[model samples]
Target: MTRTPQSARTTTRGIPRILAAGLIVVIAAIAAALGYQSQNASSSSAPSPPSPIAPRSERPGSLGAGGAVPDGVTVFDDGYPAVANLDPDLLRALRAAATDAADDGVKFYVNSGWRSPERQNQLLREAVSKYGSEEEAARWVATADTSPHVSGDAIDIGRSNATAWLSEHGAEYGLCQIYRNEPWHYELRTNAIDHDCPHMYADPTQDPRMRQ
Candidate 1:
């Protein structure tokens, strides 16, 4: 198309305003993205303990761990891998206990289990960012070196009944709660089957095992 001198001049003059409007839009989009992220972080603040367990009639299928991963179960959704990345013995014991719990109308579900060192560190950093300090974060997330999650030996059970049932009967299964503050965190303590579970640490800071 032929450009008239008058038309070319007008086009050139409008370029600055178009560039300015585009810059404004880009800045606004960035602001909106950041705001959405901040709101999501605030809303997803670490999950607090859930409510007490509600009793239900005994159900089958979830009964034995020897079978395939059950329906309605997925790694991120239910936190149970086809095989938990936990310590072999510990994972075996957990499955056995979960099978038993299923017979009693409780379904044992994993909330957190077997974290990679990188994942553990990321969680710690996030916790610190959320809690405002490392000390405060330590109360919840543990260091990668000391975290049983990183070692693939700890399991955090979900569902109140699973935890509650374990609270009362876990000794039989050799699953013991580790932290008083984290009732969901359980570890395989074969000795606990005969002896009572050890005195619980009030939090990570009190646990000598967590020494940095």
Candidate 2:
């Protein structure tokens, strides 16, 4: 027996449904693969953040609690024509020592205090011009680095007898006469860092704070 045209038409319509279902499954698989690849690429491309650095500690023997000047004392730059400046504590000690010496009939005066590096250089040049060489001038006045006056930690007292008394009793006021060769110069006996430069006669015109 022969097949009817209606039956053939029904077969064609069922084939189209099966093809559509298969196409939907293929599109879903492709979409899932693309989503997985995108997630993996994003994870691999991202960067991590860096860590922070630590701060450094302060240097030892620097001016502060254990500085050269003793506690409860402050330094002032007495506008002396010869000296550079004076530490507050050192000035207090000097005033105290001078007063004490005066009570014992020993008159005292502050001859010198701070010195600028430029003034020191001028003195050095003068010495070189008059004496002969830099070495010979250095013998009379200390080089910039060796100048205790530049540090505002030294003072030159006028009277020898008063200074002698200070040497004996100055420690009570936290003062000490540094450099045995120069009896006139006195410094604070505290724990401040010591500079190796010696004292020199500097010009009064330069800035006191700019000294070596």
Candidate 3:
């Protein structure tokens, strides 16, 4: 065999080094791609945060049923709706009476109870608007100052069953209907628990208290 040239031998040795450098670059590129893939996979699998919700008690302008009354606000108890701002004696008596009535399958509900002067006046104004005159409105709504509702001394029950029950059993609890036409209206008659309820007024017109 002829002796190889020195330059050719040198060039032949350089070829292995070039191939080794290329192999190293290829391995580094593969490792970098695998690292990126692993990071992306880990980030995509993490959990998202939960969304929030509000309860009914958080609503504005009105307190929820079954909740404690807020500060400076006179609202009803869990069992009584539309009954607020009442005399403590009256409310206590009414609740006691309602508890008894419930035992006999009569659940007493209040359709109307105490009202602020503004509320009473607004009602009277609306009534006058509906009836076309104060005289006609007096047949239904009373002046704010004279209205028992503004005084927290009156309550209005709904449902004929409850009213009928009150007609029969209310005297025992001192809740007596005070008007013939307004059979739903009742006032605490302390004497009723001992004797009998006072005779009902024929109407608001005839009630002597209305004149005052």
Candidate 4:
């Protein structure tokens, strides 16, 4: 048998060590890349923090015993005391008017109707604050004792279109706009159905009914 050369044997053995070292380097590089990718994915999937600004909550006692009239209440919504507690004659006239108004693509939304005395007083106070004095406030909000809303004899309609419709045709149903400045304000005046509405007061301050 021929003797093998030491240098050739040594070189053959070093080939496996070189390949093993390169394989180890490749495995280490792959592991590092996988780790980096996993970190990026974890951060991307994280949830966001809560919002800083919150919605305003309703104040205590903002709504009085009668409760406030909701935004979309119509004359026919008896579920609300604002509509149901109105004077019988006035409610009847409003319902009749609302029925007819619907045919013209109009809706009689009750912006304000019956209010408790407490609610009226609160409104008066708010008005006084807004207008800077009781005298000026009186032009807009009446005293709780004298306010027709407390007695369910008054209603404040809403949306310009509804008021326009009422201005043209309210007299037919005995629903007359009482104040020139407040075309939205209305009351039942049965005579209006025949003789047309009486002269409108400049504002609530000029109406004798507000004095009481």
Poorly placed runs, candidate 3 (over 4 Å): 1-82
Q: Which digits, one per residue and each the tens of the lDDT, describe model 3 over residues 1-212?
A: 99899999999999999999999999999999999999999889977767565565565434523222333232234333335567777888788877777788877666677767777788889999999998878877888878888788887777788899889988988889998989988889999999989998877777777889
Question: Which regions of candidate 4 deviate over 4 angstroms?
Answer: 1-67
TM-score per model over all chains: 0.62, 0.47, 0.67, 0.69
Candidate 2 per-residue lDDT, tens place, 90-197, comes to: 777677766777788876655556667776666678878897976665555666666667667777776677678876677777776655556777778654224332
Model 1 Cα shift for residue 97 (angstroms): 0.9
Q: Which segments of candidate 2 are over 4 A away from where they belong?
A: 1-84, 129-131, 191-212
How do these models rank on TM-score, best leading? Answer: 4, 3, 1, 2
List clashing residue pairs in candidate 3: none
Candidate 2: global Cα-lDDT?
Answer: 0.61
1-212 per-residue lDDT for model 1 (tens digits): 97579978999999999999999999999999999999999889968789876544223323213222344442233234324556888877877787787799988766677776777788899999999999999999999899988787787777788899999999897889989999999988899989989999999899888896
Q: Which of 1 and 3 is ahead in lDDT?
A: 1
> On a 0 to 1 TM-score scale, where does candidate 1 land against the true structure?
0.62
Q: Ten residues in a row with the worst lDDT in model 4?
A: 55-64
Better of 2 and 4 by TM-score: 4
- Per-candidate Cα lDDT values, in order, are 0.77, 0.61, 0.76, 0.88
Q: TM-score winner among the candidates? A: 4
